[model samples]
Target: MERKYFDCLIQAIDLINDGIHIVDRSGKIVYYNAAAKRLDEIDVDKAIGRHILEVYPSLTFDTSTLIKVLNTGNPIFNIEQNFINYKGDKISTINSTLPIIYNNKIVGAMEVSRNITEVRVLSEKIINLQRELYETNNTSVEKIKKPKAHYTFIDIIGQSKEMLKLKTLGLKAAMSDSPVMVCGNTGTGKELFVQSIHNSSNRKNKPFIAQNCAALPSNLLESILFGSVKGSFTGAENRPGLFELANNGTLFLDEINSMPLELQAKLLRVLQDGRIRRVGSSNTIDVDVRIISAINIDLNEVIESKQLRQDLFYRLNVITLIIPDLSKRKEDISILIDYFIKKYNDKCKKFFNGVSKEVLDIFMDYSWPGNVRELEHAIESAISLYDGDIIREEHLPFQFKNFHPTKNFTLDTNVIQPLNTAVEKVEKEIITSALEQTDYNISKAAKIINVPRQTLQYKIKKLDIPFK
Candidate 1:
């Protein structure tokens, strides 16, 4: 190479993030880039012309790949090495060394190294997480009790007829070892119900693991649900999946509809045979795990969309429990509001009277698309902001204001009736309007009319309202 071109090449090499070093056949330093100086914590002034052994006294012919490559006139690749740098800071690297030959004679050697300290640290963290998950499954601890169960049936708070019926069915399902599939809209406390069922089950003493299927990609979800062996993928390590970890316990897979269709077929096989094959292993392991899966969308819709397999749906839907959305159980709103108020009052160290009538009216009127979780957040935010005795309309979230039901009643100009009869007619029209707007969902209609669900149901029956 020409001298100017050689300088340009060196400048290009200096721009690389990896450490680069070159030495003559005898191991005297010939070229070192800025990355090499930074990685080694070396002073460029002292290192430029120094012998390799003089600069790094810790490296010997036996320990240094550059020396070995020069002696043998052969190339070495991807050898991990650790040693103290120029500043005595511990350095770790994955290194590659190659001998430079000219005219069939060794003239020099070049070395490229990449820092892997952070990578190794991250690998160790993953190993620890996997290890903890495995230990919780395999070893029984006599002294240190397992991590406390997060939730139980008693923790589920609801009083609406639909909620009560679901809870009763949930408790029944908990007693059996059959697979349970929970269906509910997002934020309607599906996970809460799953956790409660796990705690109330015969396998309560065993591990209870919950994973959201939608949280990961298909390949990763497969590896997480079914254990993986080393070399399964590029950097995979041998690890047990949730199926093995939840053996003799409960495995709750949330948003199961989000899982890939192909994986759903494999899951069906597991459900059928109670056997799981790891990602890279041929052997099948028997797992006595009670599977409880949840989905926010309707199963029929999921099947039609091909998001879930028909065979898999049948296998999991053995003990299907459909949890009604918050709008379908408006009677529970007051009880839930009180529960949340007390919870936040204790958490924030504030004692405020319950929500004002206007605030409650707005809350009842607003359709909670985010369901219980949204309601809880709204109450928490109001409690945090309000310093007064009661949560007022101002404390309510902005969405509530936008969702408040209109009270305007438009009468037909062609119709004329007696005063009492007209009053009843207008009342029936308002009731019918509320029901229609809420899709005949009585709980939502009650909230819209600022009445309890039971009261709305009674009025619907008494007025002979034409609703489906």
Candidate 2:
């Protein structure tokens, strides 16, 4: 490489946010970037040219990702490593180590590491705080009277056929101790159903803990769910995870599809036998906890993509409840709007009657990709902006204003159609609207409309609708 180009590459590497540590074939550190210096809390001059074990004495040749890659001439990606640096500060990082190969011979090894120590510490603190709060609340008689789950079946506002059926099924599922899986699009009130089930179940009085699997990385999530024992890894402490905290209660794991496959296997093991072993602990503890997991995508597709494990799906999916999209159940839109209007009226201290006919028409014609949550937000936004007795089109959000109805049906009194014809026309209109909102993507449109992709495809072909 040219001198100028090599210097430019070095400067660019230093500019990256992730720590870059490059070592020679002999396991001697050759280059350390600025990020590496900051992450390791070591001077660049002190790190460069030093042996990898010299700087990070906690790591051995067998354990060090960089040395292992150099020895095996193989790449290791997204592996979490916890070690105590030479400064005696314990640090955690997710590293991707790759061998530098030139002309079929391994020349060196480079490891790009992202510092997650702060994130792990913050997560642990949050868990500890939650434990403290739970203990305090349990000790006080007055605080113990508080409800773990505030919502119930009565809290669900929809009256559409799909929603009514879902509520009925939910009540039945709540009667049993079986695992239930709630699947729906984002903002479709999956948590509402989960909470309602908990409140209606025998474990209503016990803790109703919920965690978003997508919120944390695999290692942190594993610790959070299964607890951790001291000396398990660097900086680990003896702590109870959600499984123990929510004992004799319900543990709702949202976005279960985002959980790592290996973690999912552990979860499946716990579900199979009501036994959980804390992270780094060999002894198993028996816990009676109901699992209610939620996913916001197609289960079949996720299983096919290997994002979700098939066996875990079968285990948790003993009773599956699919939440319909807002667009699919337009019959409930008016009632939901009325409900939100009254809610905001009391909240904003305004005596707003309702939305205008124009606004309602626009809402009815619009496809709500964000589902019921989006509708509530839109109503809240309009109410906050409008001081009038009724909400007008001008008070609505920009998206509502920009939306143009692309329906194939028309209100023609002169041309009367049969019931089946009218139903087909409406179905085509709804499918088309969803498709347009999703930019002609069939799979996404199917999800938005709460229909199977194959069914949507068949409908598209049968209706002679144009799709990409």
Best candidate, lDDT-wise? 2
lDDT of 1 by residue, 12-91 (tens): 99999999999997899988889988887787787877888888876777878788899988898766665666566656
Off by over 4 Å in 2: 86-88, 135-145, 406-468
The list of candidate 1 runs beyond 4 A from truth reads: 1-144, 408-468
Give RMSD (Å) of candidate 1 vs. truth. 13.6
lDDT per residue as tens, model 2, 245-290: 8888899999999998889999989988999998899999999999
Give the lowest summed-lDDT range of ten residues in model 2.
136-145
Model 2 TM-score is 0.86
Where's the lowest-lDDT run of ten residues in candidate 1?
140-149
lDDT of 2: 0.87
Question: Each prediction's TM-score against the native?
Answer: 0.63, 0.86
